[model samples]
Target: MSAPLGVIVAVRGEAEAAVVAEVDAHPRLTVVRRCADLAEAVAVARAGLGAVVVLSAQPHLDADAVAAIRAAGAGIVGVGGGPGSRLEALGIAVARSALAEAVLAAVSGPAPEFVAPPERGTAAMVAVWGSGGAPGRTTVAVNLAAEAALAGHRTILVDLDTYGASVATALGLADEAPGIAAAARAAARGEDAGALLDRHALEVAPRLRVLTGLTRAARWPEVTAPGLERLWPALRAAADVVVLDLAAPADAGASPQGPGPRRDGATLAGLAEADVVIAVGGAEPHQLVRLVHVLLDHDGPTPVVAVNRIRAAVAGPRPEDAIAAALGRHAGVTEVWPLPWDLRACDAAARDGRTLAEAAPRSPLRRAIASMAEVVVAAARAARDAPATVTD
Candidate 1:
């Protein structure tokens, strides 16, 4: 005969004894341990003493803890919490009544899966990141998104630069309305993130929307990885192409507040979830060095290098060729998109709160950005249409 499935009950209050009693009555299940708290339950799970942990809803229980417990080879069955509750949000909840029957159903099959609704359309996420030397990441992102929108792709320009968020300012929109942060907060509350995004995203042009970033740098903590984790899928469902203008840091390590939100959470999350990553860098010698470091340090998706402001004065004769050669030699980057110096066009666009195409259609920079956008959109479409792979 098959052995009874080992179950660990970690719930508190009266629910604990009730759950234990319910499990004991089951012939195919047995209560192996009654953990005092989440930590003890986690330890027991890590040691493989239980196949499933019956946990109670607690404020301290979060995605990280749930992930650790699950990674330790134990499935979770949350015993409490109603709609929109943390437990429900974790995708492991079983109703308080008929607990044993629910547990049996959950254990008999696979763990409850949280599959986001099929997106309205496949949207490719393009993340524009830099190595902190101000390689005009935002400028590149804004123009590319504009070009994509002009090309008939519904595009969203998300300013996730927590340090100095200027997408709203550059687009001449009022910063009073909370954009990405508000959507994130809604996602964290287990609300409709796509609906919130639709309400918060400002339509700058016909097909182009902008999700502004933090108004104050100190508000970085409000945009956590967990919140963005929920927001990303909603973003993809809302648009055809999502362009993320990330902050300079790729990996800022742990938060100074310890175990809490890190300032670079947005950037890291964007990079991790991106379908295409554009590493922007200036054409200057020093900027080239920093760009190489940025490219080398990046371990996520393969990035396309964009050398901005390729001027002969800054990068020597045939600046594009020179920059490409240097990046290839140093960073082993073969494919490089060179954007020329168009200070007049860039300044005009900034002053008018418009894109280069709108401000100066004839600008060399705009033309180059148009070409790059074509490539980006094609890549995004290809990625979206590609078949998903599964591994054991």
Candidate 2:
């Protein structure tokens, strides 16, 4: 006297009876409903009318209908045969007796109650920006994403630096691909961001998907704060980590269009939403001054300052000590990391469109980047595992 398990049949004519008989053959499953078409089947499934769906593997069955049923959270089983009988590709398969036995054994045994997936809304943003010219924001972002992927996290690197979009070039990837702009447009139109993601994502690394910036700067209008906010939740739900390569707003003067107000661009939006910000700086006195000024304006979490191209022979005054002192005087930046100058390795890797780890894993600069990434990951994990508290 176990509860009945509903089944939906999606074949033409009297085949419904045959399908119901097949499903009822299993002792655990009691056929509760027989659907004439995929729409009716989907409606029944959505209303919690079935535990599993048994549908025919027919050519007439629309792919969208199958996708809709799957999205509604039902276990699907395909029967009979068709040109596209490859059910496994669509995350469904024929339920044989042996497979049913395995499933029953799993269900009957003491199993942990399934924890619902995390609520999807608002991304955990991390922005990588530099203080001045060539402080290496792209390098930090690319390496951070690679480290996250290496740890088996599905990660994405988003290039939001409208002024100089070098993420594609740095990864040795081509520019013919669509990216964040497409996602933004879809969000503006109230379209599903997941569908947009599937279209624009470029798998640069094994577990890393990169959303490159606009193909050209003129397309900046296509990306707005609201659009980004709308798309972020979906992107975050699909990725374990998101690294943003941001343009240094301090160098807005460098742009030929004349220094526009910093608050007018997407860089501000990116920083405002960032959970972690990697503020890159050089050993030069002016660079340290600019870094401090920038840090003071950052309203998000405390940023980590990465000192790039620290060369004692060229830049003078022990790089780390000088950079730390300058930051301490202005913003108390005690967590400064000095990266050794490795132009040959960085240049070679960029030229070949490969990450530093893949191109020059032994470089000191690359090691520093990896260490920085580890620190960020640890902090994020600690926050996620912390107990939730309700406050009045």
Candidate lDDT scores, in order, read 0.83, 0.69
The local distance difference test score of model 2 is 0.69
94: Cα error in model 1, Å: 1.9
The alpha-carbon RMSD values of the candidates against the true structure, listed in the order shown, are 4.4, 13.3
CA shift of 106, model 1, Å: 7.8
Q: Which number leads on TM-score?
A: 1
172-218 per-residue lDDT for model 1 (tens digits): 89987799888876666556677888899999998999999898988
Instruction: State the lDDT at 29 in candidate 1.
Output: 88
Score every model by TM-score: 0.80, 0.64
Error of 2 at 64 (Å): 29
Candidate 2 ranges beyond 4 A from true positions: 1-124, 250-264, 314-317, 384-392
